[model samples]
Target: METTPTEKKSIKNFFAKLGPGLVTGASDDDPSGIATYSQAGAQFGVKLLWTALLTYPLMVSIQEMCARIGLVTNHGLTGIIKRNYSKPVLYIIVLVSYPSITLNIGADIAGMGAVGNLLLPGIPSFIFSLGFTALLMFGIIFFNYNKIAAILKWLCICLFSYIIIPFLSKTNWGAVLQATIIPSFEISKAYFMALVGILGTTISPYLFFWQTSMEVEEVRQKKLIVDKAVIHGMQTDVKGGMLLTNIVFFFIILTSGTVLFNAGIHNIDTVEEAAKALQPLAGNMAYALFSIGVIGTGLLAIPVLAGASSYMMAEVFDWEEGLDKKFHEAKGFYITIIISLIIGLLIQFLGISPVQALLWSAVLYGITAPVMIAIILHICNNKKIMGTYTNNRISNVLGFATLLLMLAAAIALIWFLLK
Candidate 1:
């Protein structure tokens, strides 16, 4: 089992080149994602497991396009959209998307506070929420890109608890394998809603903006000039990152589906509920594992939700922005991040159900997805911006399909809501 020296060097070289992809993949497992996977397994069993697998390629394709655009053009999505598209178009899209995103961040902060309370029963949820929000804001404002990325990377490692817990549980591997490979469905409105929720959670628009912006940051971090060859490397990095993300997602569903569903626990309103339900079947280790995953993913995801919204706002308004820049250089950008975190913290005081807030946020994301996808496609295909790196025939085919699928999901979500 021991590796040769040559093999060891190769492995080290591989890891040395891996950066942005790992971060992107890790962020995908945010607190909202943990809630979605937990709810799916608790309610529908493993029936929706295939969705995780199916979503991986779609996510990779969309994110790779975003990374490519950022690396090739040396601009974020909003900057490109503002320059190429009409002001009216930019105004309408940013107006609607920005507020919804900030609202979702608030909901995530509330959810984090609720989950934190479970971990530390003596702490008040509101205080913990507010304190954590301030800490995150301060970290982003004061820390350089390397420090921020390092902190986020460690937070991401916390998600691996879910992977370890599944093995400790008495999993029905035969059934889990079946569910993962085979597609299943029901005709009820609730089923449709759940489907919408899963799609929204996985193919999030904020992630697209964040991943693309991070690529630009990565370029600056390495002090690399923007060029065709470098852009291609960025695409490879994106694919590698998303691949890791999908692998983690698949296992999350596998663990929850096997442990929670098979036990006949059909409803879970929070991560704590899901964790406790696994105790009788999967033991104390399972509970600890689930709790740890929730805390870790929440920390990793909250900043992303806040930061992405900040980047979009700054870019659209032409404010200087980037984690690499000093505080004075990006004052508006840092201030916007703080304001978003504050708004998110305020939601905890409203006494709203975190689960309900998460559900509604997912629905809102589902509704907005189509419009964002349309804009992303237009921007990526524009030769004026992308130059020779514009999306080719295959990219267009995949991108178009992704857009159509999201549109259908959005329409279906609306229909279910109306019914």
Candidate 2:
């Protein structure tokens, strides 16, 4: 069973290639996403497992395009939009993104705090939320981008906790496999809403901003030349990250589908609820591991939510920005991030539950996703911008499909709300 030197080198090279893409994709499975996937499984069992399969390609295609745009343009998505698109368009994108990103930050912070309190019953959740926010702010402000990126890479290991949960309980592998391969559906408004939620969570505007900005950072930090080999490496990283993301997504749903649905606990509204429900059914180990994952994902995601929003503001206003820069060097950028964290933390004090925050964030995400996707598609395909690195035929096909899917999901979400 021992690997040869060639195999060892291959594995090492694979990991070395994984950078911004890995962090970006791993952060996608934040506490909000955990709640969504858990709710899907609890309500419909393995019937919705195929969503993981459905979203993988779409996620990879869209994110790869974003990464490529960053590499080619040497600018963040917001800056690109500001330069190429109209002022109103840029403002609208920023306006929609601000609340959505902040809401997500608040929800993630609350989820982590609640899970932290679950681990230690004596502590108040709000106290834990405040402490985490402070710690994140300190690290982001003091530590350089390289250090933060390394920590984010390490945090991705936490997602493996969910992969182990389903195994702790009894799982019908046959049914799980069938559900994953063969899609199923129901004709209920709730089902559609859940479907939309999953889509919106997976293919989000915040992630688009984060991915592009991080790629720009990666290029600048490493001084990487954007050639064919570099592009291929980025593609590999994005594929690996997104593939890992969907795997985690698949297992979370599988765990809740088999464990909670079978136990008749169908309403999972939050990450803490999902973790707590597993304790009696799947044992304390499962509960503890799930709780740990929630906290870890919150750590991984909140910075991304706050940073993505900050980067947008910086790029739009031409403020000196980068995690690599010192506090004095990019005061506006760091201040925006600090302010975002503070505002997001304050949101928890407004009597809003994490689930409610997620719902509100989801609404904004749905409204803006289609517009963002359309813009990304336009950018990736525009020869004048991408130059020689324009999206190929397959990329265009997948990109357009993603755009259509999000558009339809947005319209459906609106219809559901109206009803």
Candidate whose TM-score is highest: 2
- Look at candidate 2 and give me any clashing residue pairs: none
Mind giving the per-residue lDDT tens digits that candidate 2 earns over 1-419? Answer: 99999999999999999998999999999999999999999999999899999999999999999999999999999999998999999999999999999999999988888889999989999999999999999999999999999999999999999999988889999999999999999999989998999999999999999999999999999998899999999999999999999999999999999999999999999888998899999999999999999989989988899999999999999999999999999999999999999988998899887888898899999999999999999999899999999989999899999999999999999899899
* For model 1, the run of ten residues with the poorest summed lDDT: 13-22
What tens-digit string does per-residue lDDT give for candidate 1 at 268-350?
76666776677678887777777777767767777787778878999987899999888899989988888888777776567
Worst lDDT run of 10 residues, candidate 2, spans 347-356
- Which candidate should be chosen as best, given lDDT against the real structure? 2
- What's the residue-level lDDT of 402 in candidate 1? 88
Cα lDDT computed for each candidate against the true fold: 0.78, 0.94
Question: What C-alpha lDDT does candidate 2 achieve relative to the native structure?
Answer: 0.94
Error of 1 at 271 (Å): 2.0
Model 1 ranges with Cα > 4 A deviation? none
**Full-model lDDT, candidate 1:** 0.78
